[model samples]
Each structure stands twice: as structure tokens, then as C-alpha cells.
Target: MAVSRLDVFYRRLLLTKLFIGGWGKPEDLKRIFEFRKIIGDRERCKSLVPKDYPVYINKTEDLTDCQIHDGFFMSPLEHLVPGILPPEAVKARFQFIVPKKWQRNRPVCIHLAGTGDHFFWRRRTLMARPMIKEAGMASLLLENPYYGYRKPKDQRRSSLKNVSDLFVMGGALILESTVLLRWLERDGYWPLGMTGISMGGYMASLAVTNWPKPIPLIPCLSWSTASSVFTTGVLSKAVNWTELEKQYAINSVYEEEIIKLLEYCGADSFKMMPNLLKNVNSLEHLLGLSGDHEVSVSQYSKTQMEAEVDGGLQGYRAGEREQQLSSVNSKGTSLDTVTR
Candidate 1:
């Protein structure tokens, strides 16, 4: 009997998943550590920013215009501070819809948008707005970095520069959410919770993970293993793995050299590379490891997902590892480097 292409692919995927430990036990701390290191530094990534710290409302009356919306210009903390050029700068638009039964002092739910192709408008309308309104809560729709309004017009669509730029934008968005939450607290509006879909879900995970304080986070279609996305069969087409593998290999060879430059700087383990590189060729085989859906239905339960998000947040707060995941500045300084 002849083997079909689908059969070959499934076999390869199973092996790759086993090698990468994608479907392994959750309590495997070693796998968790390896996974985190592969993603570089989540904190150093870019995200959204508010135009103003206070986010002043022009008129109290305008709040009554349930359908009114506006954009505000704000830079993430890294961008605002001099001597730091972390991957990208984030400028986000604030979108809101006032519900008919709006209470003046009700808590607000902020929805962070997801990645690829577009921004958070559809998510805001379909998910965030409806949920917020149903709960009698106000809502704010935050655009992800390198998405919707934040994407540069001159850049080619889905290019490496565009993708890299979005990573930076993601970091900025995290910081922006933190600042916005603080601002809202000052204004007497409690941040009830946050939710995201797809890429937005990724950002929400990072936000809760990196946030200094505990915030209620609900990330739909979330995955704890980012390496799985790059190394798995499903997202192989999404990112140019062939090119990325080359980059990862180059970075691996220079890891020691790079570390020597920042002796005092914090760094994560370097074990994630070998698996990532080894599995690069087997990505197509791993498709059957998980389903076609973005969400990991078989591997992670709802409780498990929530716990992982919480664990990521705790990791950030504890500062168990260094913040600099990659070189963000052209000067060869790591993103986490603090210069006086």
C-alpha cells in the first residue's frame, strides 16, 4: 500500500510535537522555561499608548453621544523615554460605545485587538461591545500595535519589517493598557476586565503577564506555547519559518558573544533554540498535532488557560527573568538595558 501525503504529514507532525513537547504535561516547568526563552522578552515588545495621561474628556455631555468615537496619539513608555528604541512605537485609537442604560460610574471593560490583516473594530463590535453592554458596563476598544491605524502605509503588507514592527507595537500596547488602566482608576472608572481574540488574545496574555498589578484578563482562543505557533504545522504558513530559522540559527551562534556585551544584564535560558531549529523542517508534519482552529481545545482546558495567564502575570511581577529579550536599538544594546 502507498502512503498518502496527508498520512506522511500527520506522522511528521506527531513526531515534531513530541520533540517540542507541545502536548506535554502542564506541570513540566522545564518545558515552560524553554517556551518562555524562545519567545525572547515579552516585556520588551511594543504595544498601544494613550494620547494623554489623563485622557481628558472634552465635554461631559459628549460622553452621552453613544455612537461617537475618536483617536488619540500616545507613545509607549519606551518610546517616550529617550535612549531607548524598543522594536517599535505604539499609537492607538480609543473607541467606545455608550449603552442605552449607561450608568455614570459603572466599571469599564477594555478590549485589546488581535493580530494579522486588521485591527480591533470587528472584535470590539462582535465581542467586547456586546459583552460590556450586556453587563451594563462601559467599553474601550484599543487597537493593537502594527494593526489597523498603527500600521504604516508605506510598508509592504505582511513583510518581515511589518511583522517585526507589530511585535514592537505589541509591547507598546501592553504598556499603554497599564497606563490606561491607571488613568481610568484615577478617573473613578474601575477596569472590570479585558478580553481579546487571536492576536489580541496574545497581547492580552502578555498584558496580564507583564502587568505589575493583577488585572482580570480573559483571552479567547489563547495559547500558552508561542513556540508551538512558530514550530507547529498550523501557523507555519503564517510566518516565514525558513527565513526565521536562519535568523534564529545566526542568533544562537552569536549568543555567547551577545551575552558578554551585557554581563550585568539578565537573560533567559538558551535551550529553546535547538528544538526550534531542529523542528523547523518538520512544521508541515505537525498540523495534525492540533486542530485547524486557533484555540487549543484538546490540549488546554478553560481553567488551565486562565492559570497559565495568571502564571505569566506572576512571572512578570516577580521579575524572575530579565526583560530584554532581543536587541531593540541599532546601537546593539539589549531592549532591557537601563542607561543613566
Candidate 2:
């Protein structure tokens, strides 16, 4: 039987998610490295640090002296992929606000902004200034990829036209977040937490979940599972599916095939459980559940074994890890998976 266009697109998404979710495994990592090597030529990975970015510090001199510092920030460090554009094609700025008294030792809170563009968080930082001041914690804000100062002028609004672009941008943002966090940690600033709303929130969740070195994260107003959005009919509007499908139709014939592959691989199902659980553990267990009420663990495990005959055990293990991670609430929120 032939698959529909939608099914193929779904499969592509599944494969992409599986690839990203499995990034930490040695074998999976090797596969990714190989894949990149085949596609990326011999070019060196892109640098997370920009050239000649300045750092600024502002101090408030009342009874309690507070300070704000600015510099280039990198987060979720991974290998960078160079663009076809010039070296200066993308530029970004990052700012940190801290209480002057605690400058010697302070936990850092990195703020990621939502969809409008890069540097949108700059204004958001201003809005959050009073709360940050009162809380007496240092706050850092960095640019989102393809937004604000980081966006290449020629690509304005163009990047948002495709779903693949969104995923690539998200991956880049994740890489940037990791790199920035590591850089700050090396400089003696501890990453206390990360917070964002909407798209930023989604990115924040990904960073926390996939960080090479874990960091506390507070992701507001974001769903836990990609499946929930995509399968629940909400994706059509949230992601502008109509537009995405149109673009994919024009750009590539394999889009449908990829989507179908993702669906068969259960990407849609894996993406939705987090939001439904509200808490993490239940979410994880649910994800790990390979069978319905009628099926037993042995049966499910056997089924998984069958699925892995050709794909390798990494896919099964990836599913298990995602479930395990989802079940635990690392953020200590009211929605505690353990306690509940």
C-alpha cells in the first residue's frame, strides 16, 4: 500500500526527532558525525563565540548596589555548521544583570525569548528588570537564531517559511545555549536556571533535557510533547501546516516519504505525552509504554525487538530514555511527577 503525503511528512519528522533525541548515545553520535561529515565537506565546525563582542556592566549605586553585565553568550554547545553567507552574516548580543554585592558568587538565570526575532528578549529583560532586581539574581539574555541582530538581512521572514528551517534554527539555538552556559560556568558563574515563554520555553525545555551538563530550567507555557501539538490538530495553526506543506511540495518530492517514515516510527506519539502528564514521570512511563492495556511488557518488548532488527537498538533505547526523563521533574515545580 502507498502512503499519503501527510504520512510521509510525519515519518520525516519522526526520523528527525529520533535522531535528535538519540544524540547523546555514542553510536548515535557516531552516526550523526558520519552523516554530517558526508554532507558538510571538510569545513571546520562553526564557532559559538563571535569575534570582538563587547561585555558591558551597569551598576546601580543606591543603598544596595546592583550590576548588569553584557557579553557574547553561547548555549547548548555542539558542532557548528557554517553557512554559505559571509563570516559576518550573523551577529548577536547577550546581556547579564546581577546584583553587584553578589557578583563574586551568583547563580545565573539565562532568558530565551520567543518567536518574533532575535534580541526580542532585550525588551523582555527590561520588563523582567524589577523582578530580577527584587529577587537579587543575575539574569542573562541571548539572541535566538534567525531573529533580531542574528538574522541575515537577506533572509528576513524567509527562514520562517519552512518547517525544516524552524528545526535547524532550533537546533542552532540549542547549540548556542549549551555553549554559552559552558562558557559562563568556566568563568565561575553557575547556571541557576533558564526561563522563556512560548518558543523560548520550548527551546528552554530542549536545552534542559539535552544539556551535556544538566542545568535547572523553567519553561513556561510550553507543551512537553511534540506529539500533542502535531497530532491534536493544534499543529495546523501553531506551525502553519498549510504554508509548510506548500513550501515542502515545491522544494522537495521526498517530504511526504519522510513524513510517513516519522509516523511509522511513532514520532507523533512520542511528542505529545509531556503535556498530558503535566508531571514528568507519568509522561515518561507513558512514552515507554509500547502497548495498550491489552498488551503485556513481554509482548511490547518483543515488538520493540522486532522493530530494532533493522534499525538497531538505539531507537528503542532512545524511546526509553525520553520516557525516563519525562517522568522526573528537574525544575521542582508544583507539577511534581514524583510527589504526585
Candidate 3:
């Protein structure tokens, strides 16, 4: 089906202005790279979020269909980043909307802010209010760092000053989401889930991945990764690519060191063939292939695999490392299989 003209127009309109400034300070990204090892591992990432933190509820308003509860907690990033963060961005604010009448399931979904979504107004009026009235579902609208009440005074609109700012926002949200999820669980909220639009959606996905329990995740207008958005999506127009390219060409550290680190850490997707092959058997199950039609990477297509490894044996050997870690299967998959 073809996309409607109105859809095209609105998407363009929404993505018009973003990343106004050039990649602010190349060194800023190095800060993000430092946390890569921890963030890449679920257990390590969860360790960053404190198990105990006080959430101070400041205000409450009784609505016809729901009650709006406002509260905030000190951002965990404050201690992590120390002097790097602006004062205003330290406090994580949120709006919790609970239905007047509780449903039997008592489901509450966390809503994360998307690009240009500065405050709770858009999510509250559009999602939270409607959800509660219709299904008696509750909502917790999280104010992303460098957005809304947490936005730095020096930052202009929602355009983050640095690339690291985006990473920091995601990290903060992941930690904060865990805190909220735990709080909700303690308060007797069952069947918790998370949802967000665009960038918010991506953040929600990341947050959900770190969660130990099974929960519903709705990532609207997002993909498994943000690379496609920056490279080819409508949002690409908003980036200062000329500046990025110019800096990449001139900066030896960014061009050389970053590339080396990414590949060394197995973060480079192109160099992930070994990891891909390790899970190749799972593909058979995914494809619903029977025992009679069993297929291995080599047996499936020798030509395609050979073509991918241009330099023959040396190319295949390069990916093999003694310290490489194997991927763990998700509990959900095992549970589903057992039920079946």
C-alpha cells in the first residue's frame, strides 16, 4: 500500500527541526562509549539502578475519571555523572494517572517522551487520560532528561547540546523506569507494561530489555535500533551531517580509535557473523523447518556465506576470539515452548 500524502506531510512536519547544533563536542561521545560494556549486558545495566530510592509525591488532583499524582525522584545519573550534568536535569519528574475505579488486573503502563515531547501535556492528554477513561488503565509519564522539567536551562528547546546527552537520557530512563516499575509492583500494580512514541519508543524498548520479568512493550514508530532513523529516515534531514562528516574527516581520534574500539568490543554489526552463526540453529526453529529439511549455515547456501566472507578463511578466523561470550536465551521463549 502507498503512503497517504497527509501522512507524509505530517511526518515531515513533526520531524522538521531536530539536532539543530552539529555533533556537539566529539569527546562527549567517548563518555557514552565508556558505559558500553555495562549497558550491553543486562545484569550490569540493572546494577546501575539503585534498589532503594525515595519518591517524593508533591501534588495530587482528582479528575472525574482519574486522579493525577505528581512526583519526582533524584536521578541516578547525578551520582554517576557528578559535575557533568546541569542542576535542573538532576530531578526526574513524572505524572501518574490512576483510574477512579480500579480494574481487576490493575495494569499501568509507563509512557516515555519522544523527540520534541518536552512535558507531560502531549502524553497526558493523548494517552494517559484516554487510557484510564476507556480501560481503567493507569499511566506514568516519565520526563526524560534534557526534556521538560529536567531540561538544562542552557539547552535550546529539545535539541540536545551533545550526542552524549541522548545516551545519558536513555541510560537515565532505563534506570528510572526500573525504579518506577519496582514502586508500582510494591504498590500492588500488576501486569505492568511500557509504551512510547518514536525516540521514546526506542527508549521504552531498551528499558524493557533490562527488565527481569515479562511485560508488554509497545514501541511506536521505532525499530530495533536508531541507526536507520539517523541514516535514512525523515529524521535524517534534521541532522547536521555536513558538520559530522567534516569532523570525522579531520578528527584522528574519532576516525581511528572509535572504529577500533567498536570492532574490538564486537559492537560492529558487520563483524557479528560469529555471534550470528552461534544462534544459527535457532533460525531453523524460527523458520519452522522439520528434521527432514535441517539446514546449517554452510549447507543452506555456501555461495552466500562465501560471498559474505570475501577474503576466504582469514575473514572467518578474524571473528573468532577466546574471550567471546555466548548469547543467553530469553526466559519467555523457554516458557512459550514449555506451554506448547
Q: Which candidate has the top score in TM-score? A: 3
The CA lDDT of each predicted structure is 0.48, 0.47, 0.70
**How much is the lDDT of residue 244 in candidate 2?**
35
In terms of lDDT, model 3 sits at 0.70
Poorest lDDT segment (10 consecutive residues) of candidate 2: 331-340
For candidate 2, the lDDT comes to: 0.47
Candidate 3 vs. true structure, TM-score: 0.75
Which candidate comes out best when scored by lDDT?
3
Q: Put down candidate 1 lDDT per residue, 44-122, tens digits, no spaces.
A: 4223333246453332224332553554545554544331222333445676654556555567777776545365457
Candidate 1 differs from the real structure by a C-alpha RMSD in angstroms, to one decimal, of: 16.5
- Model 2 spans with C-alpha error above 4 angstroms: 1-65, 73-79, 84-89, 117-128, 154-159, 226-243, 246-252, 255-257, 260-340
Ranking by TM-score: 3, 1, 2
Candidate achieving higher lDDT, 1 or 3: 3
**TM-scores of all candidate predictions against the true structure:** 0.54, 0.52, 0.75
